[model samples]
Target chain A: MAQVTLRKLVKMYDEVQAVRGIDLDIADKEFIVLVGPSGCGKSTTLRMIAGLEEINSGDIAIGGHIVNDVPPKDRDIAMVFQNYALYPHMNVYENMSFGLKLKRTPKDVIDGRVKQAAQILDITELLDRKPKQLSGGQRQRVAMGRAIVRDPKVFLFDEPLSNLDAKLRVQMRTEIKKVHQKVRTTTVYVTHDQVEAMTLADRVVVMNAGLIEQVGTPNELYHTPATKFVAGFIGSPAMNFLKCSLEQAAGALRVRVSDTLSFPVPADRTQRYTPHVGKANLLLGLRPEHITETRRHTEPNQHDFDMKIDVVEPMGMETLVYFSVGGVELCGRVNPNAGAAEATSMKLLADLNNMHLIDDATGKVL
Target chain B: MTDTAIRAGAAGPKYGSMSRDRRWALRWSYFFLVLFAIFFLTPPIYMFITSLKTSAEISAEINPWWVFNPTLGNYIELLTQDTFLRFFRNSAIVSILVVTITMAISVVAAFALARMKFWGSATLATGVFLTYLIPETLLFIPLFKMFAWVNETLGIQLMNNWWTMIILYPTLTVPFCTWIMIGYFASIPKELDEAALIDGATWTQTLTKIFIPVALPGIIAATIFAFTVSWAQFLYPLAFTTSTSELVLPVGIVTTLIKGDVFNWGQIMAGALLGAAPPLIIYAFLMDYYIAGLTAGATKG
Candidate 1:
């Protein structure tokens, strides 16, 4: 088990900075996932940790030992690539045992480790088959098996499941989490899929445009994102941001989204939002789950308003309803039985307790 | 029921017309195939038929295509002659050595050019292909003069030896073999070597255990090309080696089997047929791999 540490890591491709100066600390056996959209430098950071890519300026320490000039083989890290780079010529057994054989480990020990890894991956029957003979999911398992047999200090995955189909990707995501739990090795997985990051990572590091936006637990990222980007990026159906202006009311504060629609700020946030009243370039951020169909009984900080549904998508358990507020389109998830329809006004409730007020100028949550 | 019947009737004639057109097209294709096959096969067929005829039968004003008194006399004569056997041995040794040397040098050079990037590597790769374009016919004169200079300066006899062809053939074969191997090596994904690198494999191990096996088809194709070029090469062996024992198959057959204005047609045809045997057998067995190697650059192997 090892903890990984990065200090002011920076990488530049000519003039474009792929990874700017950033620092992070990962605990022992912690599965940390670096997640972002394309070209966000998540993969670059993982490659640096694997010693596949040289860092322009930084110190990467694995198990508290700095490995700046070490080559990838000496770094004691195993990587599973996006395309499942299994030795196409070697069968599953040889692919798994290749690293140990290179290090001149005893043949019996190599065989034992390979067999154990195959058993853990549930691919014992497939040991004799080549990579081409296996399915996409099986190949991915072999790629993971190759890493596990090495028993390295760290495991680096660069979007290993991206090549599989959607259903297989989800299955492999769970499979990866299970394997990580069984092995408990320090893992650094990189992906553009937030759902994969949220499901597999012990702690998710959300990156945006070459910098770390936030690093927190999955639930922490979901419930309390640190920045506007994180708040917008963490949730599916994405948190909607509506341009609004804070206003002073009789004894409370109100966020006026349009000339006709406004939400009263919760009593708990009134003191914090008092200074932002009449502020320009302010946005009210609310997740799709936070806005739902109205109920017979209302809770504190829950306010109701009417919206004309532009589209209604029924997703078995939940119905995603889309509507517009002052020219900004917003999505809300409601119960499938809520009777939502096209071009019809429906009463919806917005929970102010889960709402985030963001500064549009700075892209930060207040 | 009437509409369904009409629909079925409409589709039936279209399917029939398509099959009829395909049948006629197939017949036309076979006809041209036979025509082309006869055109290409006539020379070798004549050579085989003439090799069976005695010299008297060949001189007689009879059917040239028909072997009146067919015998294996020419084959028996050439096989018994020590000089012809020496020619065969020289040709075999030269071709085998050239293939081995060409593959060894090309595989290493291609791997370095394809995978390991450094200063001027791209230009060097292009330069290698450019060397292949310089035909040996134009360079043989300079090479001939260069060998003389080597003999005069270093006091080493670099001419009139069967092994000297081994040295000259790679200049013709290495550039092309290296080009083919570079294409094969580049087609492999970059992540494969990176995976091997992380597996604690040295660069040499990766080349031997990973690349050589993966690019075996291309290597085979290159080996065949090098062997064929060295085996059938007439000009270089003629200019470099003039003695009867030092001559390889192609040049030895013409120089020894045909005296001044007098040709031993039966023995010459038999020797030519025997010389063609090795390449023909090789191609018959490895035809698929040769085609795959040739097309690998256009599509994934």
Candidate 2:
């Protein structure tokens, strides 16, 4: 059991800093995913923790002891590389047993550990075949098997599923979760794909540029995002942003978009956000599902837009209607039976109760 | 009417001459390949023909290409001669010793240079490869004088013997062998080493268990190159060893096969043919390794 911690971790490659002062505490048996776009320093952070990379300037503690000077071997960490760095010359049984052999583990014990790891990965039948003889998925399983047999304190995966095809990636994604269930090793998994992060991580660390933008449970990142980048990055198809201003009318705060749409702020947030009224240009953030289609004209139209529908995408179960507001195109999911058509004028009901108000200057939830 | 229809169909000028150009391209490839084969094979084929001739027929006014009176008398004479066999034995010993020494030094040096990433590593590696480009002829005079100084000052004579080559051939073989091995070791993905490290392997364990096995092809290529280079070496052996027994294959044949000022052409060619056999046989069997070792770094660059 290992709880890994990084305090003020920093990595600078020449002048470009890849990881800038990342501090995190990964608890025992927790599957944490460091997710971001390419070059977001997620993988660099993982490598630093694995001791594969020299910690440029930081303290790394594993299981309550400072392990900054420990080499990867002494750290008791097993890393699965993106390319599945399985020794191509060795068969699966030998591959799984290689680390134990290096440690001079007894022959019978080595055999037993390898057999157990192979069984866990469902690769027992492929124990005698070289990596080249195995398919891509099988090679991946052997790579994981190599790590599993070691029974390492921590498992470091640097995008292990990135090399597999789409169907295999999804299948292996679940298989990885199952492996974690069996072993319960504190795994530091890295990937740029957010879906993998969402589906697999106990806690997702969203990184941008070189800093941790936010860290929380997957549900927290989806429901409530701390920054504009996180808000836009976490969800599928992304949240749409419209430029608007906050104004007061008859002592009630309302967000006005051009002169077309006006959304009233609830009483609880009025005092907190009323100081910079009119001058405070706030971004109106709304997820696609919250934007709905209204029938004809409705009474008490507090949230409404006369959006011209440009493309209608009907996904049998639901229709995704695309329309433009002040030259910014936005997508909304509607019931397929609602008869959402393309190239027609449509009235959209902005679901104000479910709507999120984001400060335009700083992308924070209002 | 036919001319008008043809003109209408032939709207573009490029299509008409394209097929003609392709035919010439094909013809040129065949022409050069055959030319290359002849240019390369002529010397060895001529040597074989001369080796088969009797002494009288070799000196007679006969076509250079033909063995007029076919005989293996030259081969039998060289094989039976004690001094001639000594020359072959010396050549074989020097080359084998040098191959073993070069590979031992090169594999270690290559591993360190390629993977260790110490100070001035890149510059030192480039220097090693560059040392190979400096011809042995250029270093021969310096090396000869150095040996003479060692004999005078340190009281150990290294010149004029087969052992001299044991020291010098490694100088020739190690740098080139190391450079090729470096290329081979570098082609092994860094991930393999990383995995090995996490598997509780010290750097040495990783080098032996993983890197060596993965880089075996490169090792074989380097060994073949070292062997071929050491076996065929002429300049060092010729300059250093003059005694009949100490003379290696190349100089041995030239010195002994001449009587006074008269050249024994048939016996000389026979000795030459025999001397070339080991390397030729090795190359024929392991040509794939030889060629791959030479070109493995091209993919790297």
* Best candidate, lDDT: 1
Supply the DockQ value of model 1.
0.44
lDDT of 1 by residue, A1-366 (tens): 589999999999989999999899999999999999999999999999988889999899999899988999999999999988788778889989999999999999999999999999999999998777788889889999999999999999999988888998889988999999899999999999999999999999999999999999999999888799999888789999999999997979998899999989999999998988888999999999999999999999899999999999999999999999988999999999999999999999999899899999988888
Give interface RMSD, every candidate, in order.
5.2, 6.2
Q: Is the docking of candidate 2 incorrect, acceptable, medium or high quality?
A: acceptable
Count: clashes, candidate 2: 0
Candidate 1 i-RMS: 5.2
Give lDDT tens digits, candidate 2, residues A1-366. Answer: 599999999999989899999899999999999999999999999888888888789899999889888988899889988888888778888888988888899999999898999889999899998777788888889889999989988999999999889999999999999999999999999998999999999999999999999999999998888888898898877888888788899998887776766788767667876875876657777888777787566444336667778999988878889987777888898788876788888777776655567776776776
Error of 1 at A365 (Å): 1.3
lDDT of 1 by residue, B77-108 (tens): 99999999999999999999999999999999
Candidate 1 residue A124 Cα shift, in angstroms, is: 1.8
* Error of model 1, residue B33, in angstroms: 2.8
Q: What is the lDDT of candidate 2?
A: 0.86
